[model samples]
Target: MRELLITWGDGGGELAGRLVRELRAAVREGRLVAGERLPASRVLAAQLGVSRGVVVEAYEQLAAEGYLVGRQGSGTRVAAGVADGGARPPARVVETEPRYDLKPGTPDLGMFPRAAWAGAVRRALQGAENRDLGYRDPAGLPQLRRELAAYLGRVRAVVAEPERVMAINGVGQGLALLVQVLARRGRPRIAVEDPGSPGTLALLRAHGVRPIGVPVDEEGLRVGELAASGAQAVLVTPAHQYPTGVVLSARRRTELAAWARAGGLVVEDDYDAEFRYDREPLGAVQGLAPERTVYLGSLSKTLAPGLRLGWAVLPGRLAEDFRQAKQYADLGTGAIDQLAFAALLESGGYDRHLRTVRPRYRARRDALAEALRTHLPQARLQGVAAGLHLYADLPADTDEQAVADAAARRGVRVATVGPGRLAPGGPALALGCAGLPEQRLREAAALLGEAVREAGGTVREAGGAVRDVGGLGGAVS
Candidate 1:
């Protein structure tokens, strides 16, 4: 092992200051990684031929500032959150090995095109005017709006003009804006798919919008039930429905369009529609009647979630109200990010990156499916037509939560659709195949199978509960 090189300070006023700077530089350069115990004060003093008290004082200053975490037995290890000075703790402990993270709704960050992104940022900065730095449009930069309008037209068949497109932080904020607009119309009750995204459902409720649960089936949202609930607005993920990946059937799509045309409004969340592998891409329901549908799409899946960039194509009637809502929300998304994304779209970089990573994700998805088949032949799979994650049905006797707990104990993280249920005992586990490396994906699936077996149930075989074409099991869980 290489030894830490410490230089002695002078007796002058600047000596201690120089030493602190050197020490900080060493840590910043990763000469000291987290958890590596530092030398004792006496040892460091002797090595540097300095007074022991000096070393001790330096260590004390760092500890007080949260740079070093010290314990009687643990010595001084690097502490995370040093910059925040203990305002936040470290993130949840995640297993390092087996690297498979099948958690749902995240894209493979490893596949993020760093070079292209950097290029876009550089180009944007170079062309940016001094006035561009000012807090400008709250509805996003004009260039990005135009680029997105063009892109959405081709991909989602959205009838988006730049004027109708409003860029906001993300889906969460987009939903919030819609809630405010609908609230103005006295439409407080919103219908969500049964077993829909919990975070989204809660966000609506927090904003004083009541969300009623409507059942989703192979044909997608139950339109008749949606009407019966007396909800004036509804959120539907039509392209590849969340958790189940079911495409809204043609008949149902028409029925929904009719429903919207008659009176109600639709919030069509086009989440994860780009990653469909099986059939041809389905045009958004918004395309049929842009006047009745409020279309929401985001880069959280296609690019990365941290970007906080998403767009909503509102109908002409609701356009003015939605734009005003955005103005009061966050003054639009940051201008720099909007320009960067617009460059990404105009340059064709975003689609290129997607083409590159799609095969890699496809491979990981296949690995997960094969692992399920080999390890637990009886488990049924569902919703693999398109999307980052898929679902599997556990036997009725199996405790889905217990299996999730057991998997976590073995350093695996898998989720269940049952917990997302508006009712109890949904009997399914939602497993995401994205973000994890192939090896980890296989291991996680195998661990899940073991977890199911330990929970005292077996997956059914060939004639069992297969639902979608990609071996996604039953959604009735």
Candidate 2:
């Protein structure tokens, strides 16, 4: 048919053979539906600028393959069941677009340094050798590794060498590979913060690693509970805890390092460590216990998650195994992107970008905090010292899920802490401040306050008992 696409330049196959392939593809791909008649051989030949005999040959072959049926009077038509076999599932219905997306773990994507990054990309490509385009060391390009080692050391206080770093797709891949390595080493169980990342839990589960949930307090993951859990390894976001956004206290950091030093392993996810507001900068725990820590960092929050650029600084003992895992898992990350990021880091463009956006994100965070205080006066906010999202503990009587649903109905989307909790916890919401502007965040907070008020009464009347409300520290009202 005229609608069918055929590529004549797809190699040395005969025209009729190519026609057969195209027509077969069209039928299999649902382009030629069941009972749909194709043009006459002569007509199709004219339309395709081919000989009539070629068209006839293709038609004959397809007909014999049961893709078409022909009769003396009715001419050619698609076979009755052909299209059903090739039919695709209907597309998923997209959810309603929320007025404000307060979902955590996302940055203000519009602030990405497009020009600077583009320049870095251009320079990287121009400076790259022909061999650079081919498969590189699974650990990463030496240039990028060297740059990362220097950058991490100077910025995050991570004790890393180029040999100890392996470029990964993101923290997700790094974690997955580490899980696989641990499994091989007979350590398949890792302790995670109870109110930790649900995505992290799911990822660990997918990799066949059992995640033990340890409670998190204002000081961050409870080292006492983690030690009691008997998990040989632990995954933590020390710089800024997710959902809660609490930093690991100095005391807890010391205890954690001691635990790791005593035959334990720590996997530190240094996500969103770049944006610190209203607090003195705390270096990564890996800096304290590099020999027992696998420090993971990514550009997901700083630049864009779409870039999928990240690195893992592994302990010397695990470096070679992790490198092999990385080699087997997609043969290292994209070279061009790696080189581009390296150039950006070396040129200090990355630091400049962080400096530029830090103030803007801080402003948004301040606006959200102020709006929440003004609107939901009774709600206690926690972990606002650093990171893009703040944890808001709802009134004991409030229903967080109901509030989230009410906010969604009001065109504002927010995440509840239920999905992330391994044990029972009081109702709370994690509101992201980086995605929207200050004005929008204020508006969203107001709407959220209204939703909380509307949902509060219903939950109170239901007599739902609050559970596991002890560990989280005193509210910062």
Candidate 3:
């Protein structure tokens, strides 16, 4: 055993107990793994400025609990099987003091209603029938589908009845199911937004479906281009378009409905629709043309991402095909989670939670915008009207990866839209604002602004060029 110097608040009456608590926590967390030797009592006592007896007493207690073993003259060591010896790989870059993290699609986890959710889970377990504990309907629990239908109807105006709503694992799984069904039906070319979610693009491509990229602009997905793509189906964010925050214009929505009516299918991903700030919540496009659109939603955003609960409201024509697809895809979602979610909805807890989080999210949005305005003043902020992130168009001349790397170096994490592009290349950053605290947002922005400056670019209004104060000439054109 080597001397492990443990630090505590004060080396007084409670010092030994505190030290034992920390040591146990380290063991539990896998920091002090099985077979790892502990510090000698004398050495630890000297290091912590405590009496040796205190350290001895703590070690004895730990030994008694099987956390440690004292071999005669061999010294004390962590007990085998007390914890696994293998440790998770170290972080690529440790965040000793990360000022900001602007990676997109993450919610403010701090705002999650832990108390209410726990209570709901308990109640659900209590009320669930014996049959609910067994292998469930691959389509999902009846109660969840019923509750989800009513909830979606009220919130997004989705025309869903209990029979039409099929719960899946998450949006990813729902998309996979849709892809399988559509591909089996011979619809291979699924059009998507150009700078859409890379993961979603990859998922579509995995099932032999060709993802044709149609460009998105301030008004959202370009309808004319989508028509020109000759694709049988299109995946759209609609309410708040990914990476750009553009709501599908009413004309475009009508046009899309007409196109779908003519033949094409619209796979509506109402992602982040519940978080819209500047406008009244928009109704799902599926409501306008129920027979032509498939509405997908998840608790990933509204609740916690770990829940892995999502639903698909299929058009009447495609309902059976989707269910068959679901049957072949892992049986179904967990019954307990579905029941818990249903309880949350039935008790009006979900809406109550949403009401609380919206303001906090809005404040976060405001903080990020203010930070950008103050620090990266020359940068253009797009997608600010809604969603958890904004697309900041950097000076046209600046390479986005260089900016991303520079930000990483300074403890501010941000990403770019270029790499996500099917046909890559764009001068923009995807700045996520939800996970960061407001006080640190300013500091993070300052670091990011400094990084941009270092990368031979200037900050300015979105459309304005970044004047190269670094003397390399104007970077933005």
Q: Quick one: best lDDT, which candidate?
A: 2
Residue 65 in candidate 1, Cα distance off native in Å: 18
Which rank order by lDDT, best down to worst? 2, 3, 1
List where candidate 2 sits over 4 angstroms from the true fold: 1-40, 46-82, 85-89, 92-95, 460-477
Give one clash count per candidate, in the order shown. Answer: 11, 0, 6
CA-only RMSD, every prediction: 9.4, 6.0, 9.2
lDDT of 1 by residue, 1-477 (tens): 347775554645554455566666556556666666788878877887778888777887777766677899877776653333223335699846433445677888877788999999988888888766787777778888899999999987899999999998888888888888888887667888887775675677789976788999889999999999998888888887877767899999999999999988999988888887876688999988899999998888877888888999989999999989998877678888888888889899998988888888788888888899888777787774577887787777766666766677677766667535564435676777878877878877788778778876543343333221112221111
Error of 3 at 152 (Å): 0.8
lDDT of 2: 0.85
lDDT over C-alpha atoms for residue 345 of model 2: 92
Encode model 2's per-residue lDDT on 29-132: one tens digit a residue. 78888888888989889988889999998889888988888989888888877665667758899856678988877888999999999999999999999999
**Which wins on lDDT, candidate 2 or candidate 3?**
2
User: Between the candidate structures 1 and 3, which one is better when assessed by TM-score?
Assistant: 1
lDDT of 3 by residue, 1-477 (tens): 544435587656676688788788777667788888887889888887889998998998888888999999889888888665555546699635445677777687877889988888999999999999887778889999999999999889999988889998888889988888887777668899877776676676777777899998877888899999998899998898877777888999998999899999999999788998887878999998899999998877777677888999999988998998898888788988888899999999999998888887888788888888898887988764677777788887786766877887888778667645676445787777778777777788889899888875533335332221111100000
All candidates' TM-scores? 0.77, 0.85, 0.76
